[model samples]
Target: MADYQETLDLSSYAALGDSFTEGLNDPGPDGQFAGWADRLAGMLAARRPDSDFRYANLAVRGRLLDQIVAEQVPQVRRIAPDLVTLCAGGNDILRPGSDPDDIAARFEAAVVELREHVDTLLICTGFDTRGVPVFGMLRGKIATYNAHLRAIADRNGCRVADLWSLRAVHDRRAWSEDRLHLSPEGHQRVALLAARALGLAVDDPEAPWPYQPTPSPADLRRENIQWAREFLLPWVGRRLRGESSGDHIEAKRPDLLPL
Candidate 1:
């Protein structure tokens, strides 16, 4: 199998996955979504200015690989996309009470379905959230999921974007308020990973990731406390007061904000 760039034309591609590919919170200029897929599409568009092709992002928040297999795969088959990028299985692996075996199976199914249609397919692995509490199990599950992805892609002659390695080695301060999701900067990093894997380039490689929101520990605490005093306390005040406040803290709590 050839590399992503060598196999498909960047101008005509499609993307499929969940929130990470949709840019749920990181909306770009003119209200364009700012997920890695969108960033990559924009980059490719600029790289081939005369080539007017379309990129379809069929991703939703909280969707697992099975959903992609059931929903997005059908549409992609109809579109007959020149290239397709998939970044699923994250929500499935991270969800509470999730079954790793099921997640891997679903991922395999998605890859199989995608391969039937697109000539060049790309699979992105998940980040290493080992530092997050109760996620030790998830780390192993992600490895298993990636293994399945690789096996399926290889068998079908598709490309794999090593996003897991990139996130593992790069600075993670670029993440967003919900440590689970990426900020605009983080999305940009992801975009670069995809671009390089596909052998494309953003107009200005140095241009920022659009929106960079840095929330420190202090910011989180302030937001949490403010939320407690206003919206939360009003509805569940007495009940929350009875519970230990520490339990409400996010998994990866930033240091206490300075008053």
Candidate 2:
């Protein structure tokens, strides 16, 4: 529970980072990547229905922490939105031989730069990938990163949307078919977390997953093989060729506009 009793006077918002912030996999009203940020923006607009509320999302898929700091942090200074939500560094840590501490330093620098400009800053922690297939191995690294992030938030007076402890997203159904990005429901769950972190009340509980029998060992092994062939192999191929899914993609909402 957020245990938040009051909300700030939120008017404008800006979201920065990688695919998670960009709203990939979760289709929006216009049928674009409308992930947690878009959903949270909707809630913010709903709070001030007749008033002017604007939001911008500058996140792109496959963006590294450095890319986010270099590209998106400057926009916060220029736009000077009332609220800013940044969720970066996942891509960097997923890369071979990347260090969580190094990524945290860059993230903190961006946070410091942003704190001066925005009224509220919400920083998301790395998700706990335990129980997932390939991502399970990354649990320890993500935990270390989350610790760093929590400390950063405390030091900088930023709010944290702690994804690691969110039980709703740990369910298998919360993930997309590829099991890399979140499914639409997962995105919705995160948006609720974001709103709660902002001291906004969220009364509804997340929907429970449908009942399913536990998978046998063979079933799991078979699924892993299929996933590796269809998703992992292609991702590895992209890495080898130094390409990104967002190489040609641009921000869905590049400028702050009325919701």
Candidate 3:
């Protein structure tokens, strides 16, 4: 962690993005996703129990960068949170024939707009997909987007949590069965990373994961087949029909409330 002056006064936080930020596959007891944003909020609330820590998450599943800008950004701006974390454009980059530069440009515009409303804006790079199956093909696009994000963060005053460089997220167990969203454990790790990026003191922020043995050829084949049937085909169908997982879904936590 980089050394900086310690001033952890996270009284209000707002999270904006897509399913990744919505905590897909990391289902909470109420059937809503409690992703890294929630975990980080919980931690912050814990640290300052005496303070009225509030949080609002306006992320929804399968949202494109443009959708986030149009729908979520306005709500966050209205809230005028003390801190805001934005993680979008992953869905846009995943589309067929999508241009990373175009997506990045749109993403940068959102960041510029949001940062104007809040001083502490947090951005994140997409994760590496060295081991993911079909999704691995888009690693180049993800990398390009990540590079743009770094540049945007530098030019703007936003702090970045570089998920692309986090080796732990590459583990198979870190991802859900769909290979798109992170598992609960994966969300926990990401929350730790985000907290550390915000200069919050956390225990074992750099904790290591145990090595995972490579799956046998037969096991890999079986898993791939299952994934194709369970996730890939449905995802493709949605894209073809111009539908989204979040087509009619609403934000789980739209209002800012005590965490």
Candidate 4:
């Protein structure tokens, strides 16, 4: 492996990929999305307060795996940070007629390149979407892609942030109103998972959710209708028109500045 400035004692971290890493739906006090990357950065920084730890998140919403490789991978290579996290392919898998094998192949290629530069390259698996609405239909594909991601991790000696095994996120509370992105608690849990993957002692990512009464059948019908109108339809329209929510969106944090 090439010389990384810090190995165990990480002084900098970077994140790459799409909306999840960009911290979608997990709003901060200022209303900015302070997704898992930011939360993990906090954990990493807290681990070593003596040194100046820098962090950057070069993730944009609605980006495909190829887009992530093209746009963010080079920046990661250039910066050569100590620790790097990559979570991609969700958007690609969401597309109609998407091939999990192909996405995994490209994802593997990205992982191969990324592992060479950083001291520790952490890659994430796709979530088990069985608990999510609409997306649940693609669970097979996502699971297939996740299997590939795990294989790639083993082959490349990269760490895995195994989102598929996280039972907490399987609950409805972990998802946002749109049922697409994670909620604040969900992002925090993901951050904890990442920290644990990095060998940090952290909270249980699988902590049980608070109690809630199951909705009636009529309530489910009403909620489904509301969801279709408010979120699903707009998403479908964007897909049909070849328009992305991230058409003009830029990475929230492009530079590897001090944390």
- List pairs with backbone clashes in candidate 1: 218-257
Record all residue pairs in model 4 with backbone atoms less than 3 Å apart, i.e. clashing: none
**Where does model 2 exceed 4 Å of error?**
1-3, 204-207
What TM-score does model 4 achieve against the real structure? 0.94
List TM-score per model, in order: 0.72, 0.95, 0.95, 0.94
Residues 229-251, candidate 1: write the lDDT tens digits.
Answer: 66445535533454322233221
Encode model 2's per-residue lDDT on 103-133: one tens digit a residue: 9998999999998888799999988887777
Residue pairs in clash, model 3 = none
Candidate 1 runs further than 4 Å off: 1-7, 133-137, 167-170, 201-259
Off by over 4 Å in 4: 1-7
lDDT, candidate 3, 119-165, per-residue tens = 89999999888767888888999999999999999999889999998
Roughly what TM-score does model 1 have, to 2 decimal places? 0.72
lDDT for model 4 comes to 0.88
At residue 148, what lDDT does model 4 achieve?
93
Q: Report the C-alpha displacement of residue 87, candidate 4, in angstroms.
A: 0.6
Query: What would the per-residue lDDT of candidate 4 be over residues 1-259, giving only the tens digit for each residue?
Result: 2122233678899999888999999987656799999999998898786858899999999999999999999998788799899999999999999999999999999988887787799999989887567888999999999999999999998889999998889887888989888999999989988888887777788888889999998998899999999999999999999999889999888989887
lDDT of 3 at 41: 91
- At residue 55, candidate 4 shows an lDDT of 93
